[model samples]
Target: MKLMLKYLKRYPKLILLNILGIFSFVAVQLGIPTVMAWMIDNGIGNSDIAYIKKMGGIMLIVCVLGGAGTILLTYASSRISTNMIRDIRNDVFIQSQNFSHTEYNKFGVSSMITRTTNDAFQLMLFSNMLFRTALLAPVMIFISVFMTIKTSVSLSLVIGGSFPFIVAGVIIIAKLTNPLSKKQQKGMDQLNRISRENLTGVRVIRAFRKSEYESERFAETNDNYASNSKKLFKIMSFTQPAFFFLLHLAMMAVFWISSLMIDKGTLQVGQLVAFLEYQFHAMFSIMLFSMVFVMYPRAQVSANRIQELLDEEPLVKTPTNGITAENKGVVEFDHVTFQYPDGELPVIKDVSFTANKGETVAFIGSTGSGKSTLINLIPRFYDVTSGSIKIDGVDTQNYDLKALRQKIGFIPQKAFLFKGTIEDNLRFGNPNATPEEINHAIEVAQAKEFIENKPKKLQEYISEGAKNVSGGQKQRISIARALVRKPEIYIFDDSFSALDYKTDATLRAALKKETKESIVFIVAQRISTIMNADKIIVLNEGEVVGMGTHKELLKSCNIYYEIADSQLTKEELER
Candidate 1:
């Protein structure tokens, strides 16, 4: 909540103007009752029609001024609240962009989405109510109190007596709803997570014939969310009726008591009427204030959630004096070890290797053997717990992140593409790449034949997540996108898994010629995919158990022999 004030401070002049508008509105409201009292006492009582006419005209002018002030108040309040929301949403999104994988895991994708869109919207609603109703409530109450006191002290006491009861009711309702509001927000996050999973895994669910199970899973969260919302709204429903009942009860007492005072000649009829009018306005303001109390608790919950994300310091911070790579296409891992932030054991341990220009280094191991994790280190996705990874003889951490990444072309295991034309997606790697460069990359990646078959070629639209393309096609285009950069270091993280053996062989053969000046690092599960590499690193339980060529490893390393025996025929192995 305190953080939100930072954005509000940006528009000081608007706030000042809104304050002026509120003052004018309150003055006109309070003045109207007073003018009516004057008309009754001096004009009607003395039988002077001119005085009555003059007071009526003054009353009309006051009403007009009040209407104008309301309009100004609406405009200024709306402008400030909306602009503040826009700025806050932009900051939150930019902040999310800086988050590392560690932070992403902590918050999860669905929770971050909820905070960015839904939570920010909740704050906007609260701000709107604050400007239009919350501020006016207190000001109107104070002015009404002062005016009523001047009219008749006895009637003012009636209005004042009702204040404590209303305050207590509001306090009780706020306490009850606060916990429910927080629970509601958490429930909403869970529901969103379930919905996201359902959408992304819809095919998996249908393939497994688990549609009923998925439906039950969604229903459970939806029911919990609905129940929490119902409880919160039920508690809030008490606020309006309770406050109105207390206020009207006081109003009836004011009229009852004022009648006796008038009959006794102690108070005039005009003053009694004016006091009742002021009492109505005073109680009305408190009712408005109760509305604020009802809404503030929920907004406070959302504010805390958004603030949490903004306050998180990114684990990976860009250095102010970061250096660039002095030498190109050389990568080294010296006794590198890494563990996830929450993991009990390291994923890669005491592993060391190097791949220089014009060399192809491959890694192969069973699942959970740290193959992907080792390559992830060269790009500094996660910093090593011990030892160092260097590019061009300089420690990766010391190099500017953007400068370091520019030298490496990385393809993840799952190929993701944005919703755009083929040209648009390819240009993401090198925005300044020319058509000739693009065609060359497409040819080398073995994607030219398929791409040219399309009616639009490079201009063809790719759906979100590249769903319009086959798995093999997506993999090839991903490789071409990386090729457009012609980076000094190429990392293929099980990137050939989707390609048939023949296509995989062809792509790797063409890559050798195209990347003569680059260092290629490949992570593969298939023995055939990496058997021809210049050097192969075999990982076993987070440790490199073998390091050599295919023949060297087969003779010297038993683990390599068993892997080769399982995949190749006896005749092939003998050869």
Candidate 2:
């Protein structure tokens, strides 16, 4: 409710109109019975046809006004609810954009999707019910109760007797369903997670022949969600019939007592009919109020989930005022060390290096050697645990995040492309890039041959995940994307592993001329890929065990010599 009120307060005029509609509706509902009672006593009993007709005309006018009120109520409620949800969804998406890699790991992707779409939708449904009935029921009950007492105090007591039972029933049902609703929502999150995994990993499952195992895993989660839904439905189903049974008993009691009063001539037929109408209205209002109680638990659960997302504070904080000074493309890692949020030990420890403009530096290490983690720090994907990283003699932390990232073009190990045209994906690096720039990037990436052969050329549609292209082709396109940016620094993290040696050698030759004025860092497992690099830094575990050129390391470092010996023949090593 606190979450809902924050957004709902924006529409004060709609709330006022909704209140007016409720009053108009209540006037029509209670006024008709009074007019009918007067007609019975004066027109029917005295046989005056003109008076009866006059009262009927009044009844028609009251209903017409009430109908207009109903329309106003529907329109107001719809606008308020839809507008509130739109605002909420927009804020959730904006908040998610600010989250760092740490925050993304904290709350999984599937859960965030559920909160934004499913949880928000639940709140919208509840808001519609709240605006339409939650306020109207209380007003109707108060007015109907007053009218019943004025008609006859003795009969009003019977209606009053049912109040405690209705209130108690509502309280009991809410308590019973609150825990069940919580479990149901969690079940929904798990169900979404499994479904997403199945869709994205379909190829892996087929390749490993684990189709049956994956199906059984998904079925187990689906069945749990269905079971929770069934329990909620059963509880809701039982409530309505039980409440109606109680209503019938109250009605019987009212009719039996009213008959006695009329038989002794203390009450007239017209008054008896009017009293019954008031009694029905009062009881019906209670039923409507109880329905809100029944839905409250589920809405509360959804509201809490949405609130969690909005309340989250990202681990990475952007400064209010950040430095945007000009950089000369000098990257220095001074005794830098880093540990993951949940890690027991550091992944990159006591690492120190420097690379200036017009230099090509390479990192080669065994698996689990922190090559990717080391480069990720340069872009501030994760900050250093101990020392500072400086670009052009200023701490990377002090530089504006956007300005720092704009200076570098990073190509990840696993290539990923969105569902769009080949030209569209390339333009992501530089939205306003010219055709000449695009052609140059493609030629350097070794992607020009395949792209030109396609029927649509640059306009060809790249399927989701770039599944339409082979692994080597996908890597080339990803490399082309980075080249289009032409940033001051380039970081390629194992991006050439997918390519054959012939293509790898050619791409490097092209990059040598294109990136001569920019700092380049490459992380590779193959020694041949980095043999011609200006400098090579070798890592073992998290520490730098060797640092020098290809020949210098071959003579001085055993690790470098062993890696080279495994991949190169005696003739190649001698050369």
Clashes of each: 0, 0
Give per-model TM-scores. Answer: 0.95, 0.95
Q: List the residue pairs that clash in candidate 2.
A: none
| Model 2 segments more than 4 A misplaced | none
Native-to-model Cα distance after best TM-score fit, residue 369 in candidate 1, in Å: 0.3
For 120-196, candidate 1 gives per-residue lDDT tens digits of 88898889889888899899999899988888888888888888888888888888888998999998899899999
Compute the lDDT of residue 567 as modeled in candidate 2: 99
* lDDT per residue (tens digit) for residues 171-231 in model 2: 9888888888998889888988988988989999899999999889889988988898898
CA-RMSD of model 2: 2.0
Candidate 2 lDDT (Cα, 0 to 1): 0.91
Off by over 4 Å in 1: 40-49, 265-270
Error of 2 at 374 (Å): 1.6
User: What number of backbone clashes does candidate 2 have, counting pairs of residues 3 or more apart or in separate chains?
Assistant: 0
At residue 320, what lDDT does model 1 achieve?
77
TM-score, cand. 1 vs. native? 0.95
